[model samples]
Target chain A: MKRYGEFNALNGASFQTGEDARVVALLGPSGGGKSTLLRVLGGLLVPEEGSVLVNGVALPKDPEGALEALRQNGFVFQGYNLFPHLTALQNVTLPLMVVHGQSEQAAQQRGQELLTRLGLFDHLHKRPAELSGGQQQRAAIARALAPKPRLLLLDEPTSALDPVMTGEVLDVIRELAQEGQQIVLATHEISFARQVADWVVFLANGTVQESSTSVKFFYDPMSSLAKEYLTALTKYR
Target chain B: MPNSLTRRLIWTFVLIAGASLLLYATFASVHYPWNWSNAWSYRFQFLWGWGTTLAISLGASIVSILVGFGLMVGRRSPTTPLRLFCHGTVELLRGSPLLVQLLLGYYILANRLNINDPILVGMILLGFFEGAYLAEIFRGAVESIGASQREAAKAVGFNKVQMYRHVIIPQAIRRALPGTTGQLVSLIKDSSLLSVIGIEELVQKVRIMNSSSYTALEGYLPLAAAYLIVTLPLSWYASRLERRFAFET
Candidate 1:
């Protein structure tokens, strides 16, 4: 549970990932604590009451220990927060060299590879400002993947992109999912969630209203709150 | 582009030459009992004073920028007491007039601390005074960065030091540069305040020359011109920097 002064942002929101679920999606409305939950899972937020465990390792309270635990997760933010001062290549290679302590040559090679794979090889020397929204998000993904983190956490990755840009970014993520990368993304794109995610978690008012396989959750919701959410989501689709 | 810039430069130089000639003609023809020769004679002393001013400004600016960086870090620290201390320090220094701060440093603080070097004392006082303003520039620059960047840094598994060194400070410094240059120009002007403590800077030398020669037009005019010489190019370069770092979103 997490409290923002008097308001409870997360009220005993208990959830357990399936043993085989590689791509889990947190589906919900605005202010539903989906982003908060993703942050907690990524070890970015220390919940006031409950513990977060990733890959059987409990996230620690000490700052140093938290940094160590955070190494396992790579996050892609809604804004695609690429370092503005650095070129796309530098944005990807910086964390590898600085955080993971990779050699310059090694980091460069890895960054180049990832950027190329994301179809951004020509844009390597360009700064984030020079890239389109979709390209910037791809560079952000390359940056997140450079460290080879165990899990990827995406918080509303497509929220800032237009429909075309959204499709482009989602395609990159879908490719990663096909490659068997473990991911937990908070998204409002219900169709994308249904197509990409193996497990779906419906969150409303800081509580987990329903959790099930994506197929079941999409067609048959267990909770009335989940049903209402599905109805609203379907109306948009 | 080069040709146009060169033409502009030539025009600027022509304008300056014309202004100097006009000023010389005005003073030489209108003013009585004026010895332009006597004004030229004080060039050596004036040069020395200019050099002293430059040295003080350079030393003070370096110290000020470093102190400002430290204060920015302290202000952003997670610990409540440390953050409060940083805020209070910035507030206290900024709240007082720099002239009063200099007076205290030279008159009371220096004596209480038994500091003998007037130059060193001047640099420290000036640095601390300017640092308060620079701290605000740095703090504002850092704060202007999106919170998403900080979160991205943490998610990349960066410790605080690594995060700041690689991600935060570089961008902050870029954003702070134009403002910093402006402050440094202010520092250069403020360095004249050191004359109160008998530091033989530009203004002090001008004062001496005016007293001895009794030619306000001859002595003070060139003194003003000398300050312009130092500050004009700086202002130009700062604008260039503003354009250079103006990242388009």
Candidate 2:
């Protein structure tokens, strides 16, 4: 449980991903603890109680251990959170050289390759503010993927973008998913989640409402909250 | 139509002319004999004093920034005792008047320590007095960086020192520049207070000249101009730095 003052952001929330799951989509309404759970799972935030085990390794209670766990997973925030002072290439390369102990030449080569693959080749020298929302999010993804993290966690990566931009960013994530990169993303995009996710974890009121394979969760949701949520979300379409 | 440059020049000329007229009227009404020659004879003395003031300001500026950074770090330290000590020092320095601090620092503290140089005591006291204000400025600048940026740095595996060196300090410096420059300008003005300790800085020299020439206006006008010469360029350079570091949000 994580207490943010009087409000409980995550209260006794528990869920697990399948061993072979490639893309686990966390689905919930706004302020339903999806983001909190993702942060905790990535070890960016330590819970007030209980423990998180990533690949059978318990997330340590100490800050040093928590940081070590964080290093193994790449987290993409909803706002992109790109370093404004740095160019797109520099943002990715700086951490690689400084933290990961890569040489300048190697970091530059890897940074350029990742950015190019994300279709940001022409805008490599542009700062975060100079790029569109979609482009910034794509650059953030590239930065996260630069260190070859064991697992990637995204917290509503496209929520701040318009529909057109959202589609473009989602396309990039779909490609990564197809490439067999393990990813866990919290998202409001119902159709994209159904299409891309192998596992689904539906949360509401700071607890998991349903946890199952994407097929079972989407087609035959057992919980009333999950069924109601799906109907409410799909009704607009 | 006049472009911005032409308009700016016209306004500048008008303002200067207006200021000249105001000064002329004020001086003409005084009906006192205007004799700049008496003060002018001490040109060498004025020059020496100006140099001393410049040196003191420069030294104090460096010392204040270093001490301020150290105090800011201490204030943010995890240890309770160090944090409280730093907090108490900042409060004590900021609460008391600079004049009292300088007098007491020199008479009581320096006297006991067997430090004879008034100039050295003045510089140290002035630097520490300004450092308290600078510590707050630096702390605010560092805190203004968003939580997400720190998180991003951590997720990328940057340890505490690496995060500060690579990410936090670079951004914090940009935010701190304007305030720091303002503090430096204040530091320069505050150096005048060192005149009380017989440092023979610009103000002290002007006072000595005023006493000999018995001409307050003639002695002090050039003194005011000298201060503006130093401060105006500093402010302009600070604005240039602000523009250079500016980036779109």
Candidate 3:
């Protein structure tokens, strides 16, 4: 449980996941603990009375130990917080060289290769502000992928973009999902979740409301709340 | 010449002529004795004092930057006690008058601590006084970066040092440049107060010359000009840096 004085942000929110689920969608309403749960699972936050284990290694309470465990995952934030001062290539190259201990030449090679694959080859030398929202998000994804993490965590990656920009980012994420990247993303885009998610976890009010295969959750939701949420979400989009 | 260049040259000439007229008026109005030869002979002495002033300011600026960075990191620390301590120290230093601090450092602390080097004491005192304000600048600059940046840093598996060195601090320094240079300009002027302890800096030299030759106009004008010489270039360089960093944003 994570508490802010008296209020709880995560109250006994528990679930289990097999490593085989290539894409896990954390679908929920705003302030429904989707982001908090993603933070916990990524070892960015340690709950007061629970354990977060990824790849069979339990995240320790100490910060350094938690960081060691967190290294196995790459995270993309809602704002697509690329380093504004660095070029797109430098933003991606820095982690590979600094965190993963790759030589500059090797890191640059991998960074260039990833940016090219993301269709940012023409804009590799541009800074974040120089790129469009979609390009920036794509660069952020390349930055996360540079270290070859075992898992990827995305917190509302397309929330800051317009529809056209959103489509640009989601297409890249769809490709990654198809290539079998173990990814988990918190999102309000129910339709995108339906199209790409393998396992769906519906969260609300700081608890897991329902968990099921994507087909079952979308085609036949067990919980009434989940069904209502799906209906309400689809109505808006 | 281009029209803009010609206009600038004309303005410069007019400014020089206006300043000369003002100087002539001040010389006429002042009743103090003007021993122009004595002041001229002491020009080398004033140059030496200017050099000392530069050295002290340089030393103080370096010390403040290093110590200020430490205070900034301490203030941002997640530990409560450490953060509180850093905050208290900054508050105390910034709250008190710098002249008082210098007096305490020279009169009481020097005797108790047995550190007799006046210049070293002056530099340390000025360094800390400026550091308190610089710490605030650094804290503000660091905080100005979005919260998501830190989260992104952590998500990338960067250790604390790596995150600051490669990701955060460089940006903070760039963002804080204008404010940092402003503080440095203040530090340069504030070094004049150290003359109270017989350090013989530029202002002190001017004081000695004014008392002996009784030429307040002759003595003080050169001192003002010397300070302008130091600060004007610094201000220009700061603006240049601001432009260089603008390419990023």
Candidate 3: deviation at residue B50, Å?
A: 1.3
Q: Is candidate 1 or candidate 2 better by lDDT?
A: 2
Query: What local lDDT score does residue B74 receive in model 3, on the 0 to 100 scale?
Result: 97
- The parts of candidate 3 lying over 4 Å away from their true place are A55-57, B1-35, B78-85, B247-249
lDDT of 3 at A2: 78
Give the range where candidate 1 chain B is weakest over 10 consecutive residues by summed lDDT.
B240-249
The digit string of per-residue lDDT tens for model 2 on A54-160 reads 67878897988888778888889999999999999999999888878899999999999999999999999999999999999999999999999888999999999
What number of clashing residue pairs does each candidate have, in the order they appear?
0, 0, 0
List all candidate RMSDs to the true structure: 2.4, 1.9, 2.6
In CAPRI terms, where does candidate 2 land? medium
Writing each residue's lDDT as its tens digit, candidate 3 over A57-167 gives 668988878888788789998888898889999999988888888999999999999999999999999999899999999999999888887889999999999999999
**Model 1 lDDT tens row, A59-175:** 897787777778877999998888888899999988888888899999999999999999998999999989999999999999988888789999999999999999989999999
lDDT of 2 by residue, B62-103 (tens): 889988999999999999999999999999998999999998
The DockQ ranking, best first, is: 2, 1, 3
Measured by DockQ, the strongest candidate is 2
Candidates sorted on lDDT, descending:
2, 3, 1
Stretches off by above 4 angstroms in model 1 are: A55-57, B10-33, B78-81
What is candidate 2's CA lDDT for residue B146?
A: 87
